[model samples]
Target: MTESRGQAPRSGLSYLPGEAATDPDGTLTAIGRSWTWILGSAIATLVPGVLVLVWPDETLHVLAVLIGLYLLLTGAFRFVTAFGREHGERVPGLLVAVLFVLAGVLCLRHPMQTVAALSLIVGLTWLVSGILTLYAALAAPDLPHRGVVVGVALLGIVAGIVVLAMPTASARALTRLLGLWLVLLGIGELVFAFAWRAALRRGDALPGAAGPMD
Candidate 1:
């Protein structure tokens, strides 16, 4: 017997199979589910923030560890990217990779010292990034979400200033702030996931089938 045209066919291991391949509508609907993920990210950030607030001493050590880990990862990524560049490319990618590896190794070797040295360096970097963000926000008023850019820049600037003025206090504050941020973000992600799931269900509940005869 032939399959009924009105009934949507299910393909194993491939719920979304042929013809309906370019499921732009479905894809967008699925993407809507990602709000939960984004919210989770925000919530995760709050953990460190809270740690900084409640236990400043503990925050320092944690921050040091975080910095070391970040450096190691950065170095690895830089090295990989450098090597991944075109074989015959004249880019100084190799040099950059070497620099990154060297930095990573240094941090790993003297993780303790990195707290003082790396903290200062990272603070400066944050300051620069914050300034750049502010500049971009100001220059590109036409951008769709200029407010977000500005807000991020402002936050960065504040963080940088705090880190510079009172490294220890800033570290603690940052930790607590991060904790709170994470909690909030996690909730947001959960909400988004539910919303996306609901929307998809609604869309699939359309009335009036297109008649059978496949």
Candidate 2:
């Protein structure tokens, strides 16, 4: 049977070209359906972040292990989203997933590595993240709160540069900074998750909501 224009394909995996564009919700995908999981992950990230902050004296090995776990979880989430029945571009997601998984594996395998090496890894991660954020902000001219995103991207870039420049900084200080950043990131994720959920609810009345996985 010939599929009508704007009709979902039988694969039930993706939308027809321009289908998502015509949707009132912008784009309906498996990722949007997984908002609750994303929200939970965001909240889960806060736990270790808080613990690290409260116990700054924790051993470097312990901190490394915690960070590894966090990265692993983050990577797993990204991988799922990358290969899932999402209706948007997946190249960036795939790249990020690979980076997170590799970093997490390295951290886990070398928990006892020198502070300088670990700092370098963290710095690189932040630098890459900042670059990606800037790219995204520029790519999406219609993105809400574009100014705020650009500001955050700038801060991320500066933070990455500072960390790289001061690789000799005390391990405890670096750990504290990492912990603080994680906490803030987790909070932001939580807020975004809730907002996404709200938008999904509001979009439920639209035709896109009837799409597969919606």
Candidate 3:
């Protein structure tokens, strides 16, 4: 339905007068289009996972290099974003940058230790994060993005388990496992991104001057 400015559209859907009517058809279409990007990200992540699984030994070294690059880039990004922001405190971003820098430096210093150390650190982080996420999911099943949060928790649990279960593995093996976890996470993120992109597109297409839902 076409919306007239300062007037409520048909359907009386809003409690407040003059609330716009949403165009469901257009919104859905927009959302679908956004999902295409997410799908692409998922495919990219899956490729790494497959390679790691197929050649665990060779993948381990590659994993270390990839992780180093990831840490460096991520840290730089965080710093840049934080510095660019005018309102928020920079401590969080600075701390993250420091951690990433440290990780990268350590990786360089002891390339052989890269995999084991990374596996331990990543495993612990995931374990804690997973528990928190699972708790949140259970506490608020109706929460938006609940499914994605739950999926992340599950992935974290699996990643943690894999790392802890093979602590004795060679550094190469550990690195490969770490890569596996990352690939899985990347896939999950891609999926979530697509879902968000779709939702955003749908919201954009909706008629009647729709705004974000609380």
What's the TM-score of each model vs. the native? 0.42, 0.71, 0.52
Question: What does candidate 3's lDDT look like per residue over 53-170, in tens digits?
Answer: 6776674456656555555544454343333111223344355456655665655555555566767755754565456446544554333355774786688677778887787898
**Candidates' C-alpha lDDT:** 0.38, 0.58, 0.49
Off by over 4 Å in 1: 1-44, 59-61, 67-109, 167-214
TM-score of 3: 0.52
| Error at 71, model 2, angstroms | 0.8
Estimate the overall C-alpha local distance difference test score of candidate 3.
0.49
lDDT tens digits, residue span 82-128, model 2: 44322344455556657767888999999998667766776676567
Report the C-alpha lDDT of model 1 over 155-202, residue by residue, as the tens digit: 656655655665555544544443343234334333433442333343
- Backbone clashes, candidate 2: 0
What TM-score number comes out for model 1?
A: 0.42
2 or 3: which has the higher TM-score? 2
* Candidate maximizing TM-score: 2
- The window of 10 residues in a row where model 2 has the poorest summed lDDT is 205-214
